[model samples]
Target: MYLNLTPKQMVRLNLALAVLFSGVGVYGLQSDSLPISPYTCFTLAIACVVQAYYSTEKFVAKAALSNTITATDTSLTVKQVYYQCEKEEIVELSRISQLKVADNYLAVILDGNGQGYDFQIKGKAEAIIERLNEVLPKALLKNSPIKQV
Candidate 1:
């Protein structure tokens, strides 16, 4: 269930977080006592909490689920749960699709509606693509207009 991120991706994420948190902290310090006519202190407090979440690596996603895949009918259903690095909440996705792999991520295009969402799989993007392609039905691509690779 634990999907580990590649060291490169993790480093990039960490660097981004560092810059964002630093900016937030500096802004807070410089404008801490500034009075607001419309916004309340509660809003600023909430922003601080969000900034804190990004400052720590504890929020990075670690696991995802592969719930279902049906080969006979060329239909697949997969549910992937991920941690939203800053929000500290698990994002749950129930997707039924033909999988597509890209340079840095994988996209699951839904068959029924012709809609899809993308996931940035940490380290095993290529391997996951190969595995999904092997397991999913070939007929799933017959009617799909989107190109797969």
Candidate 2:
């Protein structure tokens, strides 16, 4: 089975904010009437660009996850494509620690190192949670539930 995930809305919002900040910076550099210093505006713009870059990375990861998550009878393969590079991690079913469901995200926790891979849950969150619950072993399910925020 293959499961797909969607990116969060905040990613687009961050990109939009980045563009807006850059425009403001350019405008500040051109206009004299504005009280804000060009240096300040430029700094803000750079910060926004950094924010947008990180958000873009998150968006790319989400997009990659959307196409990944291939589950076979014995193992689950997670493929991530970022910056034109493709990475794959294959885990045996027995090595899975737990499937955690929160209000907006789902996390797959690996057994030994307790590492987690989180995927944003868009529409039909309940159905996806239920499906995960049904597929994974009861022993692997986390006893402590995540609080929905």
Best by lDDT: 2
RMSD of 1: 9.4
Q: Give me the candidate number with maximum TM-score.
A: 2
What C-alpha lDDT values do all the predictions have?
0.47, 0.59
- Every model's TM-score: 0.34, 0.46
lDDT of each residue in 29-137, candidate 2, tens digit only: 8888778886776677677655555456454565433445556677766565454455677777776666666654566677647696776543245655555555545
Candidate 2 TM-score to native: 0.46
Cα lDDT for residue 119, model 2? 61
Q: Which residue runs of candidate 1 sit more than 4 Å off their true CA positions?
A: 1-75, 84-98, 111-114, 141-149
Candidate 2 all-Cα RMSD: 7.9
Which residue pairs overlap in candidate 1's backbone?
Answer: none
Q: Compute the lDDT of residue 63 as modeled in candidate 2.
A: 45
